[model samples]
Target: MTNILIADDDIHVLNLIDIHLTEQGYKVFKAYNGIEALEILNKELCSLAVVDVMMPFMDGYTLTKEIRNLFNIPVILLTAKNQIEDKERGFHAGTDDYLVKPFEPKELSFRIKALLRRYDNNPDEYIVRIGNTIINKKSYEVKVGKRTILLPLKEFELLYFLMSKPMQVFSRDHLIDQIWGLDYEGDERTVDVHIKRLRERFSKLTDHFQIKTVRGVGYSLEVNRE
Candidate 1:
């Protein structure tokens, strides 16, 4: 079973997330503050993390920075602040995703699963042959034939997820839910941002191997079927 650490100052929030995640087959760990979160991080291998932005001792951004330096574990920041700058800072700080307050428990569960799916599938060689591109999961490196490309973590996650389910059309909401999380509180444009990044990266692989932007729909990874 995957292990998840959920850190929030609100006891009610912690309990709610714990129950929801536990029912979904994850080993849930709770921390009321950043200090406790660090303690949990020191002791175990967590597949994913859910952190609140505000708390005593250390904030979510600080803890995320520390965790990023130490591990490639995927993180979702929970914040009451829904500002664009906060989202940008969370991403810049190396959080894999973010969720604002007033989110649904089911949404939280989906995001956790999506992040876990991305993290747990990573292997040491750090290279994935998706279509004509060879993705280096570790260095965030991508190689299409002889060209080398670097990708942001979110872009990498999006590309990896789409490639994992080639030809499947993921609706914007479903894609967001699959990649971001159910409780992921953000505009759908977040998915668009990463998708654009993925397209730019794959453009190096030849436009033939690309993510199709389904009009009035969502996106799909469609390798040349001809």
Candidate 2:
């Protein structure tokens, strides 16, 4: 059974989400604040987390960052702030999805299912090697030479997809569909954000392989021959 954590300052909101998620056959953990959420996460293995933005002690953005650093679970932020900037901030903080407050419970369930399905569907167990970088899809591990670095779920997926098909140009739309899913309502710029983070994360490792932009087309992974 999959365990899900729901954290919100509002008791009504927490209860609502808990009831719905539990009814959907998920084991639910409820927390009223980000601090409590962290405590639950420390003790329990949650498959996914639904976090509210404005919480006591720790905000959702900070909690999401902590979760990303410590856990590999997917996160969906729930907040009343629907501004593009707010959504971008949530994503930048390492959330896989964002849902505005007063959203339909059914929609929330749908997003949860989609995210879980995507996470569980590993392309293959085969290890991919490019230059000094080694990508192990099975273990969700990336090693640059002897050093191992962690990446957020979406970023890792993007890297795996690009590396899986080196030198193959992928359009932004294609990547967004493949990675974020066709039902993704977020801005297409999300792809650019993940790509930028990937470049920055691996910049110090090696230069033999690079992710290149094809101008108006999109991006591709280029492996240089030694």
Candidate 3:
């Protein structure tokens, strides 16, 4: 079983997340504060850590930095503040994912799963398969059955990224930064255009998966697992 560590000051929030994660078959190690959290970490090899920004003795950012320097595991920072600066700081602190307070437990579960998959996979080489669709990073081709489809460079990169995380939603800004360079000066709608092209190309060609827009959020590739 995969072990996860959840560190937070609030007992209610920690227990709530623990119950949900335990129900999902994860062995959870919980702590009421950052100091206690590190104590648990020293003994247990957790697959991932869910940490709250506010904590006694040490904060989430500091704990995240310690984890990054000491262990090779994914970290998700939870904070009540949804401001851009806070998010930037979290990212700078080496968090693999971020969640605002009052978030749905189900959403946190999904983020955890996605980050696990991401960290487990080799960044430079790996093939992602969902349903009948296969994204081959080595060849830069998407194979749907026997028919091999080659997408445009950006389109292919975009498809590969979305397929990589499967059901996880990625905002337009995040997508742009990953697929394109941080120095990319183009409009954010570049992501939209690529998504549209990928959808149009694959819609009639396969029933394996879909690039779904999440309205206010962004997009996720929903796999037809059944």
Find the candidate with the highest TM-score and give its number. Answer: 2
Stretches > 4 Å off in candidate 3: 123-226
Over 1-226, each residue of candidate 1 has an lDDT whose tens digit, in order, gives 8889999999999998888888888899999998898777656657778999998999999888866654457899999999999999999888998899989998888887787777667583255454356666667776777888766667777776675455668888998887778999998989988888777656755654678889999988765522
Worst 10 residues of 2 by lDDT: 122-131
Backbone-clash count (model 2)? 0
What lDDT would candidate 3 get against the real structure?
Answer: 0.85
TM-score of 1: 0.55
Which is superior by TM-score, 2 or 3? 2
What is each predicted model's overall lDDT from 0 to 1? 0.79, 0.85, 0.85
TM-score of 3: 0.54
Tens digit of per-residue lDDT, candidate 2, span 111-135:
9999898777745324666667878
- Number of backbone collisions per candidate: 4, 0, 0
Question: Candidate 1: where are CA atoms >4 Å away?
Answer: 123-226
What candidate 2 gets wrong by more than 4 Å, as runs, is: 123-226
Q: Candidate 2 lDDT (Cα, whole model)?
A: 0.85
